[model samples]
Target: MEALLILGGAVVFLCAWVWLAVTSRRLPVGLFVVALALPMLTLLLRRKGYSRPARLLLLTGILISAAGVALLYREQPEQFDQLISGSWVTQPSDSALSGTLMQQPFVPNDVRWQGKHLIFAEKAGERIRRSLVVKFDRAEALLQGTAIDLLPGDTGPWPELVLQWYTGALEQPGLRRLDGGYSMSLALAAQGPGQTEMVVHLHLPSEFGTRLTGVVVIDGQPQWLGKSAAVPEPRPAPEPAPAPEPSRTWQEVSILALLDEPQMYVGQAVRLTTTSGKEFAGTLTAVTDDKRVVLALPQGANQVDFQFHPVDIQRLQARPRQ
Candidate 1:
C-alpha cells in the first residue's frame, strides 16, 4: 500500500512538472530539472526501505511542484486563468478562430507598446535627445519614419539622415519606409564638409506584434535602441521672480519739512492723518506756497485735489514711489 501511494504521488508530480515546463515561458530550466530529480530521489528512497524519509521527500517534491506552478500562474495571472478555464485553446483548422483572434487580439495588459506611440531616443550625457521618429503599422508590417540628427541644443531640425534602399535608390521626400522590422541600412549624408558618407545599420525585431526591439549601428559601433516618444515636451517657463519687499521704515515729519524741498516728494505718495482723526491717501500732486498741502485723489476716472492746512494735519508720513 505504501509503494502504491508513493508511485501515485510521483506520477502526479511528474505530470504537473511536464505541464509547467511546457506552458511557462519563464520557467528556470535548472530549477525544473532539480524539481524533477527530487521526485525520482523520493522513489529511490522508498525502494531502499527508508519509509519515513521517503514520505518526507515525497511531500517536499509535491510542495516544490505546487510552488512552481503557483509562481508561473502569478507571473501572468490572466493568461493562466484563461488556460485553466480552457478559453485559450482553439482549433487551428477553424476559420472562425482566426477572425476572433484578429478582432480581439491577445495583447498582454502590461504591454505598453500596443496602440501606443513609439520614438527613438539617444542618450547624450545627462540629456535624452530625440533621434528618430517612427511609428509601427502592425497591419502593414512596416516601420515608417522621418529620421533626424538633432544637435545638443537646437530647436530646429539638424542635419537629417538621407535614407536609401539597399539597391541605391534615393530617399523619397516626406515620411518613408525605413525598415520592415528585420534588417535595413540608412545612407546618411556627410554632416560637414570634408567628411565621407556614413551608413547606419538597424536590426529591429518585432516580438509578438507589440514591441519594437533593436540595435542601431553607426560607424561600426552598435548601441541599444528602444521605442520612446519622440517629441520633447514643452518645459514650463520659470516663474517670474517675486517682487522685492518694500522697506517698512517711515519718518514722521511736520508738513513744512516735506514742503521745504517739495520737488523730492512731488510725484511721491502720501498718507496723512488729520487732528480730527480723518485719513486720506493719494499722489502728492502739488504743495502750495501758502503752507497748504494738495493731494490728488481719484474720484471716478478723474483726479480731485484735496487741500489741507497746517492746523488740520496731526501726523504726516511720506514715502517715495514704489
Candidate 2:
C-alpha cells in the first residue's frame, strides 16, 4: 500500500512537471531529472529502511512540482495579455507595420514595411509620414458603443506619433481607419544620419472610462518621404471636358440592307458601333446568313477575327480603301 501511494504521488508530480514545462515553454532539466528519479529514489530508500526519508523526498517532489505549476498558472493571464497579433497598417496610408518585441524591458526593433526591411534616408532633413491599421474582434461593437476619439501624435522626429492586439491569428493586413470609423496614426519624421525609427501605440478606454487593453505597438516606415519642409498646396483640378454626342449615322444605316448584300461589303473596311457604346473598326471579312458579322481586326503583326451579331451593331458603315 505504501509503495502504491508513493508511485501514485510520483505520477502526479511528473504530470504537474510536464504541464509546467509546456506552459512556460521551458523545460527545467534538473527538475525533470529529479522528477523521473523520484520513484526509484523512494523505492531504494524504503528498501534500505529509510522510510521517513522516502516520505520526505516524495513530499518535497510533490511540493516543488505543485509550486512550479502554480507559478505558471498565476502568470498565464499576463502572458496572454503580452501577446501581440493582428493586422497593422502604416503611413501615407499604404504601408503595413511589422516588427519583433523583446521582453525583459520590452524593446521593439527590426521595424519593417509590409514584412520587408525598412529603408530610411541616410541623410537628415527628410520629412517622413506614416499610417497604421488596427483590427479588433469586437471592432464593430467597440466602434458602435464607444465615442472613438483618435488624436494622432508622434515622436523621434516631430514628437507626435503613437501606435496596438488580437486572437485567432489575423491573416491579412487591416484596412485604414476610414472617415470617423477609426482614426489612423499620422506623424512626421525628419530623418537623420543615425537610425530613424518610430513606434506607435494604441489605447482603448472602456465605457466606465477605464483603460481597455494593454498598449498595441505598430512599427513601420513612411509611404511618402520628402525633404521639403513646407508642403505645397495641391492645385485645383481642371474641369473635365463634356463628352461629345454619339454619332447619328447609326440611325440612318439599315441592318437588313447590309445582311441582304453581305458579299458587296465583304473585304471592305467597316466601322461598327454598338448600342452599348462600343465601336469596332476592321476589314469586313465575312457575313453569315445567320446574321453574324465577321471582321478581321488588325493586331500588331497579325489580324484577329472579331465576330458580332448585326443586332448588336448600332451602326455598320463600309469605307472605301484609303
Candidate 3:
C-alpha cells in the first residue's frame, strides 16, 4: 500500500514534467515548466496563455500529479491515526509473583493495578493505563508516519528494565520522575515465559548524590515497587580526593585575614585555594560579603563549584612568602 502511494506520486510528477517540457517556449505558462525542471521541483508560475502545447501539457501534468498525491494519501490513513500501538498485561510477569501483589493496598506511593493505568503516586503509569501520544516534527513524521500512540508497560523488573517505545517524549522511560527534578536512564529490557527482566540506572546530580544500577522482575498479578528510571550517564563520579596517609595526619587551619579587603566585595579581585590546596581565580559576588566568600569556580569547574571562607587564618596563609 505504501509503495503504491509513492509510485502513484512519482507517476503523476513524471507525467506533469513530460507535458511541461513538450510544451516549453511556445506558451507563457510553459515558463512554469522551466521552473519545474529545477532539481528542487519548485512550481513557480509566470502568466502564459494555454495555447501552446507545452503550457497545456504542463497543466495536464500538474493535475495528474495532484491526483496521484491524493491517491497516495488515501492508502495510509492508519499511519496518521491517533492510536497506532497498544498492549495489555492481564497478569504480572515477575519471577517473584505472589498473591500479595494482588493484595497490595492502594497507597499513594504504591503502584496499583486497575485494568487501565498503573496508578503510581496517583499518576498513570503508561504501561498500566491509557496510551500516550507522541508527535514528531515534519522530518520525523515523514520517517515514522505522522504521530504514534504507544502504551507503556512492565517489560521487566527493576535491575531489569521497563521499556517504552511509543509516542511522546514525556512518555519516554526517563522522563516520568523528571517532574520531581529527577532523571533516569535505561540499560536493558527483555521478556520471558512467566518472567520478565529489566535493568535501570539512576543518578542524583545534587549534593551527596549517588549513582545506582539494578535489575527488577514482576511475577505477580499486582506488583508495586519504587522503580528508578535509567540514568543516561552516571553523573561522572566526583573524583575522589587522594586518601590522606598517616604521614599527612594534620589538623585543619583557618583563614582569618588572608585578603587585603576585610570581607569579600562584589567584583573584588580574588585569589584563593581550597582546603585541599586547589587554586582558584575569580571575582566575589554580592553575597558572602561578611565572613563568607562566594567564589565562582572556573567555567568548567563543576565539582569545585563553590568556595567558603575559613574561620581561622593560622594555616591557610601563603606559607610566609619566602
- Judging by TM-score against the true structure, name the best candidate: 2
User: For residues 1-322, what per-residue lDDT tens digits would candidate 1 score against the true structure?
Assistant: 3234344556665565554434433545654454445434434432333234434544565766566546545443433444455655742221111111112222111111123223333222222211233343332211222221211222332222212111111322222233332322332233344332323223223331222122222222111121234544444323324346554334465677777877877776677765434456667877787666787766668876666655456787766456
Candidate 3's residue-wise lDDT over 1-322, tens digit each? 5445445555655765665555454645535454455512333333443224444454555565566445434543322231223212222332221111112221122232233232222112323221111112211211121111111121222121121222332343322221112223322223444433433233333431323233454333322222333424323223325345643322222344434453433444445543222344454553344454555544454423343434211133111111
Predict model 1's lDDT versus the native: 0.41
lDDT of 2 by residue, 1-322 (tens): 3234445556765654444334323335554344344444433333333334434554566766555444433433222222221112212222233322111112222233332122211111121122222333223222221112232121111111122211112232222222221212223333454322332322222211111111122343333433233424433323225235443222233678778887766777677765434456667888776577788876668877755655456677765433
**Global lDDT of model 2:** 0.39
The reply for model 1, stretches above 4 Å from the true place, is 1-244, 248-251
The parts of candidate 3 lying over 4 Å away from their true place are 1-6, 26-75, 80-223, 226-322
Candidate 1 residue pairs in backbone clash: none
- The local distance difference test score of each candidate is 0.41, 0.39, 0.33
RMSD values, in order shown: 27.1, 22.8, 20.8
Q: Worst 10-residue stretch by lDDT in candidate 3?
A: 145-154
The best candidate by lDDT is 1
- For model 3, the local distance difference test gives 0.33
